[model samples]
Target: MHLDPRLSFLSGPSVMAQLMRDKDWSDSAVGPPQEWPQALRSVVNLLLGSAFPMFVAWGPQLAQLYNDAYLEIMGAKHPGGLGRPLLENWAEIRQDVGPLAEQAMQGHSRYLENLPLRMRRGRGEGEEDTWFTFSYSPVQDESGAVAGMFCACIETTRTVLAERDLRARSEWLQTLFDQAPGFAAVLRGPEHVFAQVNEAYRNLVGGRDLIGRSVADALPEVVNQGFVGWLDAVYRTGEPFIGRAVPAVISRSTGEPPYEAFIDFMYQPLRDAAGRVDGIFVQGHDVTEQHRSREALRQADRQKDEFLATLAHELRNPLAPIRSATYLLRSPAAPAEARNRATEILARQVDHMARLLDDLMDISRITQRRLVLKRERLTVAAAVESALEAGRPLLEAKRHRLQTNVVDPDACLDADPLRLTQVLSNLLNNASKYTDPGGRIAVDARQSGDSIVFTVSDTGIGLSESAIRTMFTMFAQEQTALERSEGGLGIGLALAKGLVELHGGRISASSEGPGLGSRFVVELPAAPAPVAATAASPAAASAAARPRTVLLADDNSDAAEALAELLRLEGHVVHTAAHGLQAAEMAVALRPDVIVLDIGMPGLNGYEVAQRIRAQAWGAKPLLVAATGWGQEGDRQKATAAGFDRHLTKPFDPQRLVDLVGES
Candidate 1:
């Protein structure tokens, strides 16, 4: 056989040296020893020249490797077993070795003396009971990651059998305690002295010598954390106490601060043969990562709930104003001037509501990863101009001073014009709303590095550190959400973050503490100018069309009555129903020209009502429209499938509804 390639690197080798020169190892799982890495080669040389019985089960599959002494222990399996997988040869005793090797691969080392394994050795009667004193340690690759296991084992069957009855029972129990996985220690008497401790338990106390030490002496830091008290209770009561994910601060290694850890632990009372409690057994497992992940999910769930409540309050805020304006216009005795002013108020509130709905849809699309930008080549001035137009009214209303600085107004950049403007607009509006009235605001843009940079600075109420950190997080203040005197579901900044990221950009917020003002910066990648398209002429607004009789169904009395009043002012004869079943009855009897249904109602739901109404044998069917608060895409699809000709989410433009019904 050809000499192993790695043998040349060794200064001197013994048994494996001859085997490398004579054996054909080409078909082994580890391949030829010649092709092995320097590290593996070094380890093989140590095993070969050493007097100890050492073996290596390396690589992902734990391929077998051994020295001459280990080969002697395997007897008949040695000659052809050089590089086979470890589990294949030890299949009969796999239950005992599988987990040991897997744990070793994870960088844990285990030691066991007189451990039992059922194995079929040469001419063994059935499965023979074998005992060995073994140590399994992790073998590190050149990169220092655990590659597999390095085992040093000694067959102790003869020694163990000779002293089986002569050995003290306590020694056997102690052996079992050390072999157990996880952190383990046996305490003696009420003082809970650490009579015996495993390497795992010793490591838990920062590698301090824990053997023969009392619980209080070895881990005084944990005393204040109630561990000592729990131990005392278990000792006195003689009852096992189990705690799951218990928070603790312990020094795991020397020179490191006491890091927070969670543990699932149990303290069981150990009894002597006399049946009296003699000691306590402490066993624990670290669960910090799992606990942290679960807590993060719970916090997110709480935030979402808070946002939902805030959403409901914000939706109702504008509805109240629109409702009051409708009442004023619906009165026949109202002056013509009052009616005109009410009409203006109603239109403004409807527009505000529509914008809110649009924001919700935009944020939803961004979150679901469904938003796609229509990129175009344009100057930063165009985006700035559009954003300024959107924010002007708010600035005017607040009487805030506004300043603008465009480093190069004509400098071209590639971007999605509408979406880019939206990101800036949300920042401006956030500044305008959060700042005290008559405060200062500034907007700027420039080419910085390979990025197009912009900043929106505000002199309103400055942000606190906590607020700044979570300001761009969705539903950050969702819990306790109902009241938004400042208005909105707090979605603007979160949506802005998503949009900025989509454009291969980033956004950040900073403040000089509360009352000192805040600044938000946005940066987008710079790109070369592209061919510009000819601007299309803006279409003229459609003229108001004729109206017809309309029927509105909703469980919300305030919303239903207000909407009905608004339709009447639009010259439509309006009827309102407060329940789905009632609306279905009315639709069959009156057969209004248009039927608007709410999805959620007492008795039957809106979907069922629409379905039932369409099934009616009417001379002429009315136009079916879903006008409820359920505004998801799925809701729209379901509404269409239920025979509705049109779908409109709540707070939709009143004029749009009139036009839709007018067409029929």
Candidate 2:
């Protein structure tokens, strides 16, 4: 039968309703809505005319009918979507939503919020999840029997997904802020209430309750320090404040006074949606220890400068007398008394300078751990007597009376005898200088338990407690000087201490007070109980008296000339060259018994020349001696590797060079 014209399919407002009207529906399981029973037709019209996304699954097959809004949700599946089975068109979502439709067909009405359904919509072939809050209700027939399901759904995919993303991002940001190494905090609103705080921020503030409180109220201790004002200004003016090494008094304890801390910090303005400043973002780090370390380095640099200046003054003092004495000796008509006095004075000054240089070299060698000691068993009396001989000149010059007493002359020490003698000499000279004219100085040694105890007591300018404590420290005498006229590098006593320690001994000083005299004592471990074994003493070999050809290569003319003269005096044939190339050339021509190479020479340095020489046929024929001022251990190792027989420092004892070349 034909339907009434006014009640036909054309009575709908949506584009889908109109499309459904024009399309053929004969092949569909439910046929067409106009031919369906009144229940299905009523529901289909309601679904089609609705502004919201609505659909009707009519008949047992649950054939789909929906409006334009629902068609929009279907995307490109629209035209073919109508009159088809709901299960067929949206098969991916059938498992999740099909049960709801079946419940409606069973006469039950149900509601679902955010029902997640995996579906492929439009012409897109891939299935993705979409969410919706929807209701499914049974559509009743004229007799009250359920025939289909009427569905009203709202796609909440964009809204739900956006909300989930926002929550996750918020959690991630919270984790970062809490775990940041430096301090961090966030405040909200005009009152600067702490909206968020991290662990580092809490530690910075001494673990106080900071969240939900204003800056002034939460950190009252820092308000007077101007930090709170900085925060307020940032919030009010919408600008940032940065500070470096800012001093803050933080009370880590309940009752104790606050301690100071240095902090580097920044306060940035937080703005609202209206572009009005609301609160602040605070970040900072502690830098107190770094500041103190820099200050200490600056102090050490200043002390080093003072030491160098003092060293220059001490070295120049003795040169003035030596220069005057040299001028006197050079005069052709000098009288006998004047000539002898000048000669004596020149010799004394030279000896003094040599001692200074020797002390410096010894200290340097000790510091580098390159002091090769010739250790042997010797009597304490012999060592002390040798030291007294060395110090006799200074004792006479100062007019200091000397006395000696040995309780056991046989007291023995296992030590480097030369180093031991030098140590005692240093102590004796120190005592003589500090003592007034006609004052008494005594040297004594004895056997005490398993150690030998040697004491040098002097009636001199004594030491205070603090002076005694620092007497052996390098460069420790700036304030402890006896007089500016009596000058010396303060390293003598420090050198003595180092040498004594190396010999398994201890040296100490005791003094009542200034001008009350002082006593220095040395204790050394005695030689172990003697064994029955004995070895023959080797006789010293005399230096080579016969002349041998020697080549000296040095950039310094005066040094080369002086060395050549000293070697010639020993009756050796000598050839000299001022540069490395000239020396290498002379070596091949002369074929000398020895080649003395200076490390730092112009053009082909000592190392390069040595390499070239070693490559030659006559290279290893000559004894190679690296006589240089480069006294460092690495320099010596390099010389040895470059095939040098021996390495000696510059300004070496003339006799040592003679003995070395003599052996060659």
Candidate 3:
């Protein structure tokens, strides 16, 4: 460690100073230190002794001279870079730093913050990106003329790279926030200024501008709806608020009417580092459809329960009378007159039960799209007469005065006669049931244009406004109707509506109000009278005394035997089969002239037995009859398809069966 006396001013324990002391500067542009001027030497002395990173470029070459602190900035270019020209050592950055150095040499000074440059600073040969904060000033010669440049610099590469990464992360987080499925937003401060909002949030508010606006100002509708108050509460209390199926009324566009919506949402309080509430985070889903569906399900469930109860009550009513009638018929001590009366009672009760079952089946068929109409061209008078017959008993029981007016008795309809009759009877029955004793009922059927209109009006306990709205819905009954014994199943009007619609017709009901009476109007398209249309004479009843061979099949042994006895009583030879298989065998063996089969019989159902029997030659001559509880028109068609000549529902009058057998 021998120090050179000529460069003794290169002081301190600084690494650069020691390296300068041993350097051969004779060939340098600035020349040897011994020949250097006092101004250049004095500046170099101060630069090498300073703690701050400083550099000196003296003479026309602008040869480099730097202190120990500047060595770290030089990286691998240090030691050998001590006396070289500034551009020569920092050649990678010449285009950027060279101009600053030249300006300093001309007696100008410049300061730069974070000057970016590409330089060879690492041990590797490849250039690296770098930044620095530095100031360049003039260094003068002994003659007071600027001869070189001086720089004070600090590397800022780390700080710049750190800031760049932070900005990229912020952008990524914002992207995630915007893409959320539910509406999301951030509100800042007690005033609840909207700081950020996602696409969904913007759409929820009808695409209105919202960022930077307070909730009260952006959505004024929400202020009165208590939403703004909820937000304020969340912010003030620093507690989260979660609401489910909460209703809100919002106008989707400016000047549009407001609409209601149910939403599931949460407002979560945001806190600063000190734990003081600073904002709120909002997230939610629009659940209006879900809310409506849930409410509808609840209502349907309630209606189903009520319907089951009413159905049980209605079924029991007929069963009680039928059971009493059966007991009376079984008693040997009963008088012949009493037994005859009991038989009539049994017929009436059975008919009532059959009607109830028919209504239930019709509804099921309508819902399933399986109801088949037996459409026919008939005079309007005929349908009206049949309907009047069906409803007469109820009208008489209630002591209601009935009046009928068919303006055009010849008005024709291409409709299902039975279904049309059913519809009219239902309206008449409903009218009679709801009317007070001795009330007035009227029926008016007329042809206005190409359509026939039938109106049935009643002076009764009429419908209320609310009742009218739900009158045609399944199982819907007015409170007044429910309180009365004649409420029925609440499906009479519904069934009528279905039947009317099936015939390409519409039915409507209107009322002045409760106790003010009601009117029902059914309009159907009129048809031109058929060319072959003729009034048919009613057939007189014939005594069931013609003898014939008959086979009766039923899974219920009692039913089969009872029907067989009834046929035998009509002076016909009758045999019984307890099941379908036996009936098929018996028909082939005996070749009976008539066969009555219960459709629901097991061991080969009635349909299969008929199909089997018809496959044989002798079976063609026998009349096949279907006797079962399946009374839908579809069932009738099915029985016919199975080769049955006639289809009759079970519990049909014994006399009808006897006549069917005797005729065969």
TM-scores of all candidate predictions against the true structure: 0.56, 0.60, 0.74
- List RMSD in Å for every model shown: 21.1, 8.5, 5.7
Better of 2 and 3 by lDDT: 3
Model 2: lDDT equals 0.83
TM-score winner: 3
Give the lDDT of residue 422 in candidate 2. Answer: 91
**Which 10 residues in a row give candidate 2 its minimum summed lDDT?**
535-544
Clashing pairs in 1: 5-34, 306-478, 306-479, 307-478
lDDT, candidates in the order shown: 0.82, 0.83, 0.87
Best by lDDT: 3
Error of 1 at 406 (Å): 2.7
Q: After superposition, how far is residue 477 of candidate 2 from its true place, in Å?
A: 8.5
Pairwise TM-score winner, candidates 1 and 2: 2
Candidate 3 per-residue lDDT, tens place, 1-664, comes to 7666667787667787667766798778888776778887888888877789999888888899988899888888877787899999998899999899888888899999988888897689688898999999998777889988889999999998998888888888888889888889999999999999999888887999998999999899889988898999999999899999999998789888989999999999999999999999999998989999998788778878898898998889888878888899999999999899989997887787778877888898997878888888888898899899999999999889998999999989999988998999999998888889899999999998989999999998899998898889888888897876474777888899998898888999999999999999999999988567556333322423447888888888888887777777677888899887888888888898898899887889999999999898777898999998887778989999999999887656777787677666
The residue pairs that clash in candidate 2, if any, are: 76-122
What residue runs in model 3 are displaced by over 4 Å at the alpha carbon? Answer: 1-74, 77-165, 188-193, 202-241, 248-260, 324-344, 373-415, 420-472, 492-548, 561-573, 599-608, 630-664
The stretch of ten residues in a row with the least summed lDDT in candidate 3 is 536-545
Candidate 2 structure quality by residue, lDDT tens digits, 1-664: 5445644754755687667767788888987656778877777777776789999888888888888788768887777878788888888788888888888899899999998887798656687788999999999888988888888999999988998999999989999999988899898977789999999888877898988899888877888999878877887788899999899988765786888888998998877789898778988888878866775567557656766887798778778988888888899888889989997887677677767777788888888787777888788778888999998988999788899998888767788888998999988988888888899999999889998999999988888998898678766673545363266677888899989888888999999998899999999898853334565334324334557899999999888998899999888999999999998889888989989999899987888888888999888888888988777778889998998988887656677888888877
